[model samples]
Target: MTVEQNSAPDTAQIQLTPDESIVLFELLSRWCEDGKSPTPEASCFESTAEGAVLHGLLADLAKQLIAPSKADYDSLLNGARDRLKGNWDFPTLRG
Candidate 1:
């Protein structure tokens, strides 16, 4: 029997502000607890309070992006990209 290890990196590198770190971790933690991954759309969504809040957040972000009229439209767009950026992964983050 034998064992081997790979030393390659699997994620990417990017940056996020302190607030983004908090929000991104919270969001990922919730999905992970349910054994789910965040997708552009959640197919297994329920209409419960928490589920509704999650869906609502997605919808609001979408609406602002489409209309571009909201005060924080640009910031919102950047925040999403920053949060889900590849660097959010552990190895890249810790590095």
Candidate 2:
């Protein structure tokens, strides 16, 4: 049996405001921390490929976000959230 492999690039580029990026980075970081693996063999997530992608994204965000590493991160993040809320309308979830 022969298998065909696609050679398309596996990377993507996205643009986000600094506020948005910081907020998302905080969310992702918390998610990763909550999903820590017990066994050494198992990675931080259930799926290795997806986990790797998330980790890479987190790393990228870390490089781009200075607020997360600052002493006033909570205040910075809250300000970001407030700015985002003002910029866009988010529909409330319905039961």
Candidate 3:
């Protein structure tokens, strides 16, 4: 089979939470160890202690970083686009 045949398109749309990011990283580590791809069934990090921590972190990060209003989300997205186009430097605190 060709490289294209072996690789699959990413169809899973996940609204990532910080905790989920950690669990996802852990599972990816395990998959790498086993020399296997992470399947949908294996992708779930719902039960383990680490998974719980990950979920909590994600929830907190979402609450802190994401805008509660649609307008805020749109503004943030527009700002991001402008930054990507080199129109503005991202706000960074140097201290």
Candidate 3 vs. true structure, TM-score: 0.28
Query: Which residue runs does candidate 2 get wrong by more than 4 Å?
Result: 1-6, 34-47, 86-95
Comparing 2 with 3 on TM-score, the higher-scoring candidate is 2
Runs in model 1 deviating more than 4 A are: 1-47, 67-86, 91-95
lDDT (10s digit) by residue, model 2, range 1-95: 33344655467689999888998898778766656633234553577787778878988898887888899999999998998887656675231
Instruction: Name the lDDT value of residue 82 in candidate 2.
Output: 91
lDDT of 3: 0.50
C-alpha lDDT score of every prediction, in listed order? 0.52, 0.78, 0.50
Candidate with the larger lDDT of 2 and 3: 2
TM-score of each: 0.27, 0.64, 0.28
Best by lDDT: 2
Which model scores highest in TM-score?
2
Worst 10 residues of 3 by lDDT: 18-27
Q: Find the 10 residues in a row with the least total lDDT in model 2.
A: 36-45
